[model samples]
Target: MPQADFYILPSADEDSRYQFLGKLATRAISAGHWLYIHTDSEHLAERISERLWQSSPESFLANSLPTEKLHAPILIGWQPDHIPNTPDMLVNLSTIFPSQTVEFSRIAEIVIQSDEILALTRGRFKEYQGAGIQPRMHDMRKRSS
Candidate 1:
């Protein structure tokens, strides 16, 4: 089973979620881990692609869409099957969890202050525990404040 990490953010908005992803992707890439950002839709994937590029003004994050060539270090897509199986890290940005999470060595699940997202994240945490994987929780608000 892959190690699961839940990132609880202070705000319950999509922008905050994307910001969290950008930082997480930067850290994972710096650690030499290929990142796969699985979004809920193609539009969301495109938005994330833009965010990744502008994530760091001084440094660029190599990223590409699913249909593009697989030369980038990070991939953004709505379909997990379309992503290469060799990625070391998986960042799920959607409310629905992917079934192929075990393929990656580490999975980051972001949670916000919204009730709906919070409820979904709680269920995902339980699912991970039921699968015998002990997931770690990180409250970003606590760390930032």
Candidate 2:
């Protein structure tokens, strides 16, 4: 299962976006999924955790976390979105920061262009072809069946 995290653009209504995230958190809780909220602010993480803890002590998260995803810098990871978090969810949550989407996109583009090495090194995957890699998706399906 893949989990997703979306950081709100700072200038956009921070309060509303957080409220939406809280709702997602509540859903996560009910599903028993792990929520990893990566944020730059330690205090904000604690405050969010505290609020969630109040609603479902049984599923309350122990902490907020930091993320190292290259795309999202100030990421927070939390789990179990059973109770949608509201602005009042935290007493000491930090203010949102403006997103550097354009900057990050440019950097990613540059890196990907420079790393054409993946195409050059595809031969390395050829050895693993026997294990799983296939030349085409249809061929892989035939083998699995």
Candidate 3:
């Protein structure tokens, strides 16, 4: 079976990472697909599991998946672990247990749902390194020079 995993990221329209994960869980359960989410926050995990997955967080773990399908760990730009300390499990799973999941965030949907906001966010993200990282070289030059 194909492994399912993702770092659950907001599309830039949403503000909370938890919210992003919450929505993802909801969608996954709605689709009858299961996934395991790794995070340090137990409470947040529980609430999302209840609200979205409609199952216990443990169910999310039932049937583990290879992480590669997770694509690159979509670490939030700047929350706390912004330095990027991916664990060995995530790296190893990615190579073999490829996950075909999309870390849907409200931000991403917002960008697509609203045309005006989409334009503005695109401009902002272009400057950003990833999600919240500093602007890229061109944007930096545009600002400095």
Candidate 4:
């Protein structure tokens, strides 16, 4: 079974979620992992790609949209049918559970502190458990304190 990690953020803002995602992507890349960041729409995918470029003041994380032919370290996509088979990790930013979860060795689900988000993440947690994958939780709220 693939390893699943849920990162619960302190804030409900979208910026906070994407900031943490940039950090996660940096760590994963350093550990030699290719990542596929799944979003709910093409606009979001583009938004994330832009944020990654300014993720850090010292350096920017190299990422590419699925439309780009370049084999970037991180590939961001929104469509379910366009999920890349090569990435070792999947960073799910979408509200819906990814149907093709078994394809990746690791999965990262970023959740914010909101009623709707918490409820959605809870369902995803159960789905992961149902798939025989014991997901780990990281309360980022404590980490930031």
Tell me the TM-score of each prediction against the true structure: 0.92, 0.32, 0.25, 0.95
**lDDT, candidate 4, 1-145, per-residue tens:** 7999999899989789988998999999999999999888999999999999898889999999978887789999898777886648999988887889777899999999889989989999999998889999998889886
RMSD, every candidate, angstroms? 1.4, 16.9, 14.0, 1.0
**Model 4 segments beyond 4 Å from truth?**
none
Spell out the clash pairs found in candidate 3: 11-107, 11-108, 13-107, 14-107, 66-97, 67-93, 67-94, 68-94, 69-98, 69-99
Model 1 misplaced stretches (Cα beyond 4 Å): none
Per-candidate clash tally: 0, 27, 10, 0
lDDT (10s digit) by residue, model 1, range 38-124? 888999888889888888768767799978875888988898576666757888877776777777889899888999988988888
- The lDDT of model 3 is 0.32
**Where does the lowest 10-residue lDDT sum fall in candidate 1?**
79-88
Winner by lDDT: 4
Q: Which ranges in model 2 have alpha carbons more than 4 Å from their true place?
A: 1-11, 50-145
RMSD of 1: 1.4
Cα lDDT tens digits, model 2, 8-106, are 222234443345455556665456444434333556665655565453546543333443223311225332231123211211122221122111211
* Least well predicted 10-residue stretch by lDDT in candidate 4: 79-88
Candidate 3: clashing residue pairs, number: 10
Candidate order by TM-score, highest to lowest?
4, 1, 2, 3
